[model samples]
Target: MTGSTNIMIRKLIRSLEKQKKPLWKTVAEKLQTPSRKRWYINLYKIEKYTKPGDIVIVPGKVLGIGNLTHEVTVVALDFSKSAKEKILKAGGKVMSLYDFDKLDLKGKNVRLMKQ
Candidate 1:
């Protein structure tokens, strides 16, 4: 990860420190991992596992390998250009982790997608 990404992770960790949900703690731990060990998920995999209104959090990146069949909110550290376009085309919303953190979702319907 880059220096800015490291800073973002630190901020996210600190913000989630007070949460009681194990899911948030787990997400924080995942974010703390080295970049090489982070996840890279495809759209088809997300589509397969998610419902229309779910929020999917990817700690690494989202790639444009397939299609999304429904509208879901995707939150991640980064997204490939085509991934963003495809998501928007499918009427889904893309969000950065920082913006996602500000929403204070409290882990409701937050799916942590991985490869």
Candidate 2:
């Protein structure tokens, strides 16, 4: 991550700390790791693990190595261009981890998929 991204994630960590959300706090911690060591999840894995309407949070980038057949919400630190397109084409939504802070989630059907 860049210097600015590190700063931003620190702020996010503090925010999640205050909110006391264990799930998002975990995500923030994963985000703090070196970029090279972060998770790289593909569409097929997501499709296999999640059902339609599921919210999947990935701590690293989303790669477009496979196909997705269901509509799901995916939040990640980054996404490949093809990954974004594939997710959208499959009627799914993609979002950045930064954008995740402002989202109001009901906490149901939310998953953390990482290796």
Candidate 3:
């Protein structure tokens, strides 16, 4: 990982330890690998695999090559401008892993979306 991505992974790990969210820890582990191995989920794939109101964590960035018809919570290291806009337009929530980890959302229904 590069400096920025390394920092993000550290933050995710720290947050996982503090928040006691096992899922984030797993995602952080996945993110620590080579960049080519990291996830980069597209909106269309997420739309197909997830349902409305689901919480999703992408181990890398989110691309905007597709559209999302359902509102869902998306937590990731980065997002394309169009992806963020589309998620918001669909009444979804976009949160950074660092921010999402600070929330009192332990045990909620969350899934890791990787590509």
By lDDT, the best candidate is: 2
Model 2 misplacement above 4 A: 1-5
Compare candidates 2 and 3 on TM-score and give the better one. Answer: 2
Best by TM-score: 2
Candidate 1 residue lDDT tens string, 35-56: 7888899998998999988889
lDDT per residue (tens digit) for residues 15-92 in model 3: 665645577667757766777777888999888988888888887899998889989999888899999999999899
Q: Name model 3 segments beyond 4 Å from true.
A: 1-5, 17-19, 104-108
Query: How much RMSD separates candidate 3 from the native structure?
Result: 2.7
TM-scores, each model vs. reference: 0.83, 0.87, 0.81
lDDT of 2: 0.85
Pitting candidate 1 against candidate 2, the one with the higher TM-score is: 2
RMSD of each: 3.1, 2.6, 2.7
**Candidates ranked by lDDT:** 2, 1, 3
Off by over 4 Å in 1: 1-5, 104-108
- Each candidate's clash count: 0, 0, 0
Superposition TM-score, candidate 2 onto the true structure: 0.87
Q: Which residue pairs come into collision in candidate 1? A: none
lDDT of candidates 1 onward, in order: 0.82, 0.85, 0.79
Q: Could you tell me the TM-score of candidate 3?
A: 0.81
lDDT of 2 by residue, 3-103 (tens): 23567767765666566678877886787777678899998899899999999999889999999998999998889999999999999999988777766
Sorting all predicted structures by TM-score, with the top scorer first, yields 2, 1, 3
